[model samples]
Target: MTPRNLLAAGLFCGLAVACANPQAELAAHEHYETTGGSMKLALIPPAEQDDDGRYLNLDPEGSHGSIATRLGFFGRRILTPFRAGAGAAEHTTEAQVSIEAADSVQWVGHSTLLVSMHGLHFLTDPIWSNTPSPTPPFGPSRFVPPGLALQDLPYIDFILVSHNHYDHLDVPTLKKLAKQFPDTPFVVPKDNAALLNKHGVNNTIELNWGEQTQIGNLTISCLPAQHWSKRGIGDTRQALWSSWSVTSPNKRFYFGGDSAYFSGYKLIGDALGPFDLVALPIGAYSPRDMMQGSHMNPEEAIKAALDLRATRVLPIHYGTFDLSDEPLDEPLARFETALQTMTNNLSALILKIGERHAF
Candidate 1:
C-alpha cells in the first residue's frame, strides 16, 4: 500500500478495534435510587450495553456513522489543508470572576462552563487545551483560548465530565484541576473513573444512568444522552456517556455534555425538567452523515431546548475549537435564526466566551 493508503489502513484498524474495552465490567441494567432528591421527579432507566459490555445509545442503530464513512471523513480532513487562523478571532472578557456570585453561569469556551448556584460552584466538561487531539500539534487547533484563565477559577464544589472524548474529557486539564483542588469531587459516567484515578484524580464519583448523588445541598443526576465515547484505541463505548441535571432547593439546571438530537430530551424534561436553564451543544455538526449520530446542529439544539422545557437556553460548544466542516460562525447564526422562529416564551442566554449570565 502507498503511504497514504497505509495511513488510512492503520486508522481503519484503530477505529475497528475501538469497539469493546476489556477493562470494562458493566453491570446488568437496573434502576438505582439515591438518597439524593434529584430522582424525586422521575426514574431514569439504566443505560444499555451490548453483549460485549460496550455502551449503546437508546437508539443505537446509525448513531455512529459507518466505518467506511468515518474513514472518508478523516481522509478529507487529512488531505484538505486548513489555513492557519482561518476563522474569526474570538472575543474574550477579562472581568474579575467573583467566587461568591450566586446563580450565575459563565461560558469558558467549548463545553466548559463555570457555574455558581445555590451556594455552591460547579464546572462542566472543563477543557483548556489548545487542541482536542490526543496527539496534539497535528489536529484542529483551538481558535480561542479558555474564556477564564485557570487561575481565576473559584473553589469548585464538584466537576461534571460527560464522557471520554478528548475534547470533553481533557485529562491534562483535569489533572491541573485535580492538583489545584485535590478534595473536589469529579463526577463521571461508569467505567470512566478508573482512567481519572490512573491520572491522579482520586476523588471521582462514578454514576451510571439512573443514578443520583448528593453533594452538599445539591442533587446531581446522571441522565441519558445520545452519544458514544472513545479516548484510547480499542475503547469505543467502553465507558458510558451522559448529560447532567443539577437540582437545588429553588432551581434546576441541565448541562448537556454532548449529544445528538433524540427523544430522550422530552423524557428528561417530563421527569426532571422545565429547567431554569438548559445548556445544550450547538456546534461541530456538519457533513450530516458523519455528525448526525453524535453532534446536534444549532437547529436541533433549539429543538432540544424546547424538548427540555427550558425556561432559558444557554447555547454552548461552538466557535471555540475547529471540530467540524461548518464555518465557525454558522452555529450561532443558525441558532439565532432558529430563535427568531420561536413563538414560545423560551429565551436564549447567549454569552460570548468569558461572558456570564444570571439564572
Candidate 2:
C-alpha cells in the first residue's frame, strides 16, 4: 500500500469502526469499562487479547478527516518547524546520574524521563530515536537529541513503558537498552511482550490496569489513561495503554505516559496520589479537535496536575518533536498562562532539554 494510505488512523476509523455506537461497544466490553470513559483492559498473554480479534474502548472518538486528508495536511509541514534555538543543549549535564540521588529528574527529550527517588531510578516511555515512526525519513523528526546517551545513563533499575506508540515505545531504542542492561526489568503493557521477546528482552513484566508490582523500594502501579494504541496496521488496541505511579517510602511520582484530559487523574490520585511531581504531556495538541481524544493541551495538563494534587509539576513532551501544528515553544507559553488561572500553590519546573530538576 502507498505510504499515504498507510497513514490511516489505526485508532480512529471510518464508520465501520469509529462510528460504531459507543454504548454498544461499551456494552460488549463491559469488563474493560470504567467510570469517565476510560478502560481497565486485562493485560493477559498476547494471544489471549488477540484471540478476541480486537480491543475496544468504552467511549471512543476519531477526527472528522480521513487518513489521507490528515496525512496531506501533516505532509505539507516540514519535519521540524522553525523555532529560535529549538534544540539548544546548553544546560545539559552528561554526568552519570545515580539512583542513589535523593531526588532528581533528567528530561531525555520528548517524553523520555529519568527520575530518581530515595536511591531508585526509573525511566518513563524512553525514546532516543530521530524519528517517531517505523518509517524513517517520514513522520515527526526530533528537534533535539537525548540529554544523556544510553551509555551515559546511570544504572537503571526499571523501565516503565506507557503504551506501544512509536514515540513512546521505539523498538530500535529498546533493542539497544536491552542489549546494554541485559537483565534490567522492562515493565510494559499487555500485547507488547512478543515485540520485546523478538528483540531478545528476557526480563519483561506485563501488567493490566490496577495491577501493582514492587521493585526494590519502588511500588510501581499500572493505572488507566485516556488514550489508544496501535503501532501498525490492523493492530489498534491490540495492546493495552497506561500511566504509572512510582512510590517510594520517601516520595511518590506519577508519570502520565500519554493521555488526554479525563476524570481518571482524580481517580488515580484517590487510589494512590498526592504526588511529589507529575510528568504530564502538554504538547502536540494543535488542531485541537483532532488530538483532543488522545493528547492533552497545556490548560488541561495544569488541571490534571491540580486534580492529582501534585506539589511540583514538570512539563514534558513538548519542544523536542514537532508533532503538531503548534509552534515549538507554544506549549510553554500556554503553560504560563494556564498556571496563572489556577488557584493553588504549585510550581512548574519547565526545564530545558538535558537540564536537571533537583528535589
Alpha-carbon local distance difference test for all models? 0.78, 0.70
* Per-residue accuracy of model 1 over 1-359 as CA lDDT, tens digit each: 36655464335322311111112222222335543442453546778888999998876545446778667666545432253545533666757446465689988898999988777888999989875655554445677778888987877878999988777888889999998877788989999999999998988888888777877767788999998887656787899999999998999999998888898899899888789999999887766777888889888998999899999999888888766667888889889989889636789999888887778
Which parts of model 2 have CA positions greater than 4 angstroms off?
1-53, 57-69, 77-99
Q: What is the C-alpha RMSD of each candidate to the true structure, in Å?
A: 6.1, 8.8
Give the 10-residue window scoring lowest on summed lDDT in candidate 1.
Answer: 16-25
Candidate 2 structure, TM-score to reference: 0.81
Q: Residue-wise lDDT of candidate 2 within 19-85, one digit each (tens)? A: 1011111011122333333333233111123356555433355453566655554554332334344
TM-scores for all candidates?
Answer: 0.87, 0.81
- Model 2 lDDT, full chain set: 0.70
